[model samples]
Target chain A: MVFTTIVNCVRARGPDEFWRKRRIFKLAAHYIGRRRNCYTVAIKIVHRALVYATKGRQLRKQDITELRNARIIAGCEQHGLNFNDLREGLLRCNIMLNRKTLADLAAWEPYSFKALTDIAKQKTKEDGFGSVKDLQAPVGVITRGMSK
Target chain B: MSVLKRVQQWATFARIWHVYDATWQNPFQSAELLKKYLMGIHKPIYHPMNDCGDHVIVINSLDIALPGNEWAKRVYFHHTGYPGGATWTLAWELHRKDPTMILKKAVYNSMDGNLQRRYTMERLHIFPDGNVPPELMGNVSNQIRQIRPMPKRLDHYTKEEVEKFPKIIDYPKDYILR
Candidate 1:
């Protein structure tokens, strides 16, 4: 049947507002899930909602990576290279450390980042890339990287 | 003319498959405990019929720890019963060939013998690489924050990996001949 029909049939007199709504939708999905024509739609809706809820759980992590990256970028700027240049330094040198660990070092110790920058600059010069910044500008913007 | 514009979503990371990095130190001790965490075993919402395990992607499988001399002294036994058909091998030999197998076998033993276990095991992946392709898609990005308390893991070492480990083993400078 239609949503209105399921809603009317499944309505409850429960005191809890959230529980009442959950019961209504669940009953509706249950009804639809049993019907050949509507079962796919109902399951899709449920899975969609579950994934949406799960997605919310990942927000905290994204925020933190941004914060850490910001700190590292700032550290790089103080060394006369913007975040862009420093990343070029890494790419030019083919450094393998992940963003999290690299950022942590930048935030925790200044000299270490300087050391990495110095090493990267030397490597870039040896590679004939002229200033690691010219090389790194593109790498930092790579939006889709594989292997987390 | 009607046209359908396709939308492409680019993901930045991969799903958090339960990837475990095993050291030669502790590879297989509390494998049962890890199974519970990997499978989401302690949930009221856990449907025994459903594949409810979270994705885990592990690295450093070769670094897991094990107790005693199981790698050397303890022999894995098998037999076909022809003339001298019995066979046995030490864990040390297996270490060089397949380090991940030590822990994989432990996990297999801990999992229930059922269809659900099969699917859950599929989600539990292990790799030796330092980085993997991101499993997250679109503007969605997930960061890994592994401050969670680890459940006990199974022993990973042969007695040699354990006894030789610096964390457990110690010697004075004079003890070294060099």
Candidate 2:
């Protein structure tokens, strides 16, 4: 309930001392060397690792987005279409596709992507988009006017 | 896996044979297009570590077009590791020696220099002309569209179509014949 002397009172931290260090040790369990066993060392390393983990979460999303963009660009180049033109044309035609789905279509569904590119080209040609002024209109893309 | 699932898996992983007609197409541009198929980057399930590349049969490599003066200016350099072994061959000269070399080199250089490149290239069968072996041709189920439209030469136009084309003005009957 009370320390008999001032020295003993100052020396005592709490009954939960071992548990406090144990938590840090657990986080560093996989770490090699004294870092995994020593409480002070483990705590410092764990703090740095936690910071990296936090930053990595954001980086992972950016990496995926960049990869999807690269894949889409590669697909566009193959069909001789500008990446921006494809996106603009699709938007004008009311085809709402995000990068993730577009990337998937570009990769797995080659024929579908081909049709999309054709549609994009047709839309760009119809609208007389500046970038596509020289682009030849793709044939056989049946739009509403054609259907009627 | 069950029989249907097993078959589906096989179909998913099956190597597709793609035919590309390189007539009047730029080798560098064609290389960029073909690299995706060769590396299987077109597959939704593509992973750099996974081998999902397809087989591409490039035909009419001899007809590849070089933009500007690339035929004369482009050089293929090689060295034999001797004191004076460095040799630079003009594109046209190289093309004359090997009709398929330019396209092959284009495809090879287009891909990232990695351990997988050489092996991936082996899957690409290029012919100088559309003379693929029947066995190889039989495997082809897909034809990659040419990047640029082939231009029709004046001589190749049909007489009736040429005559039907709208004329802006009739040359004066008395206009001095060149």
DockQ of the candidate models in sequence: 0.01, 0.21
Top candidate when judged by lDDT against the true structure: 2
lDDT of model number 1: 0.56
Q: lDDT tens string, model 1, B1-178?
A: 2232222111111233344445443555546645755675432122344344556555566666567767677565668879899987677766677766766777777887876777777765565444555651221232222323346453854777766666744567679665
For B55-171, candidate 2 gives per-residue lDDT tens digits of 999999999999999999999999999999999999999999999999999999999899999999999999999889999999999999899999899899999999999999999
* CAPRI band for model 1: incorrect
Q: Which candidate is the best by DockQ?
A: 2
Model 1's chain B yields a TM-score of: 0.57
- State the C-alpha lDDT per candidate: 0.56, 0.89
**Compared with the true structure, what per-residue lDDT tens digits does model 1 show for residues A74-108?**
56655555565556657755677677777777755
